[model samples]
Target: MSTIKRDKGLDNTLKVMKEGYLYTTNQRNRLGADNIFETRGLGGKRVLVLSGKKAAETFYDNDKIERKGTLPKRVVNTLFGKGAIHTTTGKKHIDRKALFMSLMTEGNLKHLRELTRNHWYMNTHRMEQMDQINIYRESIILLTKVGTKWAGVQAPEEKIEEIATDMDIMIDSFRGLGTAFKGYRSSVKARRRVEDWLEDQIIQTRKGKIFPPEGTALYEFAHWEDYLGNPMDSRLCAIDLMNTFRPLIAINRFVSFGLLAMHEFPVSREKINNEDDYAYMFSQEVRRFYPFVPFLPAKAKTDFHFDGHKVDKDTMLLLDIYGTMHREDVFENPNEFRPERFLDWDGSPFDLIPQGGGDYYTNHRCAGEWMTVIIMEETMKYFAGRITYDVPEQDLRVDLNSIPGYVKSGFVIENVKENLDRR
Candidate 1:
């Protein structure tokens, strides 16, 4: 076995900050490595960055890597609450994941899609009275309603904006250092308020003061038992609930990108409208073409060799999610926004992981990934066939350097109207 090649410096933290999603793949190209390389980041911690399908398979192997103690404290506290499923391992992870997966039944997915469709219609109807609409902003509000309703959380009609802003802060905190601290503080405060509210709701449900519908996420999580066969703590249950709630809202990013794709590629709109399979293809293309999560982090479970390179125990491993999805070896014409590429997709877990890869039930893939696809497909179909909106002058450029990047102008649309032809 050979020693892994390292990017020598005090740390490559500055490089990572500057390059963002391109960091690891840039290193691989610069070093002339076939797949894996090492670099230091964030407080001079040694990180092994991996790319490509086989590398993803190795990175996600539960026996080789674990998630607990891997993420930054700021990320854990803000983006994923402390003690979240993102920070569990072994049987604890498996059992908690089961609780989450239980809520993703086909019936539940259909319910979520219906809620999203209704909420989207209501929001667009209101937007028709206005001069312009920011799809990014409107998506947050619309999906927040869908998420809260689907999860059976009860926020007052007046408090929806506040709750939505809080979730946005949690997601926004994961970016640059200058704003991250401030964002983190805002996230902490928001999480506290939300968790407190959820804890009270769980308690009320248990005490019969309020009853979330049976089989709803809020209800199931409230009453879920942990691996030890004891009722999960109310606070932890609240975090798990937010795990479901927040990601659904985060699909706002994809909604923005999907709408942007329709504006940029007008030809796709016709295909999506006329064919159901094309909608799926369009949604998958949106996910693959856009930048959302930059990378996934884990830690070595023990010293191991990957592709003939030694990786020491407890060393940080960053999987290049963005780069992997765009790898030329895996995607033909990797930079283009082509939807037809997915028409015959083979359903490989290791490839096309805009979200993380591996088995959703056994590994660390996002539990709400299926729901995200469903929501995106519905949004694409709505944009293509059901609604007509004008894409006015706006900065549609996306800053790839920003973590969880958004279109510069938030993808504005004017003269919103229901498609009279479709009606």
Candidate 2:
């Protein structure tokens, strides 16, 4: 039996926050290991950190690892909500996941894309007359509008910004625990406010005081029953509904990253607009090249051996999401901003898992991944062809230390003009 190399510390929780996306990757390189390593984290708990394609394969093995009781209370309260599908396991998880998957059908995704196009058109027109636009801020507002409407949740135009702000606050809380004290508190409050509002909407739907369309997310979740054929708790149903739209708003990060990519790699824009396949390739590269989800946490279901190391029952495992995507063995010249790399790439879920790996319905992989792809592809095509804008020089560097990092200057653009050559 081989012993995994361990980080030198009593508890490296603070270092994890300091290093952020590079924490485990740094350890992997320092220890001269491809994937598996041991590190002590918060409260001196031993955590097995793993990365790369094979590591993802092992981390997502449902029989060996489970999500039950793995998520921290703070993360649940601020991000995923108490009863959201992210916190479920076994039969309950499958039943809830199926509800989310039902919304990912081709017809549904097409509708989402149409929404993206219309919203982008109108928003870009509005942006044209402005002095300058912040892609990050504007994307939040626009995507919130799209997300709410798509979910069958009614939000007045004036309230769109408010809802977007709250969602952004919740996501910003991803750096909670050690340093982001203010963000963590704001996230808890923001999540509470949103969840309360959603619960009321669910109540209104049930009482016939309000009606979302038959196939809309609000209608589906409000009416969904559990495995025993019982209606979900109104709060839980609301959480599920929030799950539907919140992730859509979260795509703002990628939108900003995509714009930055366009500015940095200008030639790719022409390819993105002119070639159908290149748009997808560019989006895939954007997901791989940037930081979104830092890592994912799960617990060992039972004692198991992985990569010649023993993992005991109920041990915590951290999957290095950002590191795996940039692994040298997986992606050649992992640091370069290259969309062409994905052109010859084999379609492996584990290799390019910005959202997550494995079967969406069966595993903990994000159900909104289809929505993410559609939105990014549409946004890339739109920005590449439908609009002309000037990227003013600013701090475009992404701070890797932030849990959910973003372009520092928010990808500022000026002199926006709409292209008459419509697609």
Best candidate according to lDDT: 2
Tell me how candidate 2 scores on lDDT: 0.89
lDDT of 1 by residue, 366-414 (tens): 9999999999988888888888889988899999887768998888998
Please give the range of 10 consecutive residues that has the lowest summed lDDT in model 2.
Answer: 176-185
- Write model 2 residue lDDT over 40-117, tens digit each, in one string: 887788898988898899888889989888787888889889878899899889988999988877777899999998
Error of 2 at 388 (Å): 1.0
Steric clash pairs (candidate 1) = none
TM-scores of the candidates are 0.97, 0.97
lDDT of 1: 0.86
Spell out the clash pairs found in candidate 2: none
Kindly report which residue stretches of model 2 are placed more than 4 angstroms away from their true locations once superposed: 421-423
How many clashes would you count in candidate 1?
0
